[model samples]
Target: MKKENVVIITPCFNENTTVIAFLKQIEEVAGKLPFLFEVIVVDDCSSDQTLSMLQKFSFVSENITLTILPLRFNVGHQSAIYQGLLYAQHLDADKFIIMDSDGEDDPEAIAELVKFNDYDIVNVARGRRKESISFQISYYVYRFIFKIITGKILNFGNFCMIKKKVLETSCHTSFIHFAAHLSKQKVKSTSITFNRLKRIDGKSKMNLTSLVHHAFKSFVEYAEELLMVFLRIFILVILLFFGIIGVVLYKKLFTDEAILGWASTMTVNLFTAALVCVGFFVMGILLLNMISRRNQNKTEIFVKLAEKSELLNQN
Candidate 1:
């Protein structure tokens, strides 16, 4: 039996404080796994000694490779990971594993991920979150909202293993695309519980603002999948508007003091106006989706730029 070609791709930005230790753990974990493995570290325009440190390691090790791309500006976390995954796909690896360099995701879990060979994408779900209780609660709540909006619940993050083909296809969609592409492929995907560890060296790259931005972007990016949500809301809006009017008219015709007065008229007008605004908003979103789909369907500009840049680097 041939050993599977496995590639580990990590996105590091200003991770000088933790990159060395992260690499060492990768080496240790690969030694225990029963496959031919390679490591690709993408330095996302780090201003610190992160790239320097990676270069120093790359020269000494044949199995380890490094590519540092100096972005015109910071492209955010998901785009950085997409770049690395594309690199991994170009190498023709059988499987691609993505992880963060902050040591929060345990490198040892690679063995367990590889064991789930049946799954085209294997995710390490955090069985135990190491953050504050409030943060954890908020995180799950966000996940629920995300599921409600996108029709897919993402319980994992960059710490997941995916098939090479899925990685290639998904990376082409958006600079900041999520792993939903695999799910859309109906690829065999599964999750395993893992206890998230605390960061040892540096602060988390994700701040509160960045996290919120990520959530909003995903909602917008996958809006097409949530059309049913808008449809349902639209129906409810129309029904509620008419229902209120019906109630007002019923009261005016039936009993007691005549209710068809200025207050009732104003209430009905306000409700009708609210429904009109919502209807316009939903229609606008649908129009944008139609435009976006017509534009490229799946291709993203940054991914193409990255591919071109990688080609130049090879030359």
Candidate 2:
């Protein structure tokens, strides 16, 4: 019986201080696994020495292979991972794993993901995040809003193992957000909880603005669903406006409680406010629809493979 091939794809940008240690940890873990593991690191046009270090790095195990893909430009985190998946599609592999180069995604979790051979996709959900209190609070609030809008709870990141069949289907779709896009797919999926670890080197690269943009991308993945939710709200507001009109008319015509010039003025003001709200909601729906169309058309982004090398210990 031949061992299956497993390709691990991790994206990094200016991670010079921690990328080498991350690869070594992966090597140590891959040597113990039963599968032939290949690591593909996608560098998102880093200006630092990250690419140089990756070009010089070596692995000790004969069963492990390393491939480096440095993009032509910085296409952000999600697009970089998508480029890796596109490249891995041509490689001879039975399974693919995606994760962050930062130590937060434990290399040891690879073993847990691979053990579940029955699942099409196995996700390592975040149990306890080790970030600051402010970051955690913001993340919790984003999750709450996401669930309320899309009716789906997002608990996992990019740390997951996917079978080859799942990869074939996923590569054809838009990956604005990896985990969220996968969640929408109807596949045999399961998740295991793992506490997120701290970075191996200095502070995180993502700031508050970047984190908020990242959260918004997840919402973009479910744009149609969000549009429907807004449409329903718009309908409810319109119905409430008509109900108010009916009450005002009853007071003016059927009873003597109507004050002079007050009923007409109130009705006109209420009508104007309702029109403004309706206009805002209609504009929102149009913008979201445009975004959804753009995403559908965005099937691929530009990327370049700067270097490729293989180090096999011939013992």
Best by lDDT: 2
- Model 2, span 145-247: residue lDDT tens: 9999888889999999998888877777656889888889888999998888888885776667877998978877886776677667657666766776788
Q: Which portions of model 2 show Cα errors greater than 4 Å?
A: 259-315
**Tens-digit per-residue lDDT, 269-306, candidate 1:** 75776676577667758766774674364422232433
Per-candidate total of colliding backbone pairs: 0, 0
RMSD of 1: 4.4
Candidate with maximal TM-score: 2
Q: Give per-model CA RMSD.
A: 4.4, 4.3
Model 1: lowest-lDDT 10 consecutive positions: 297-306
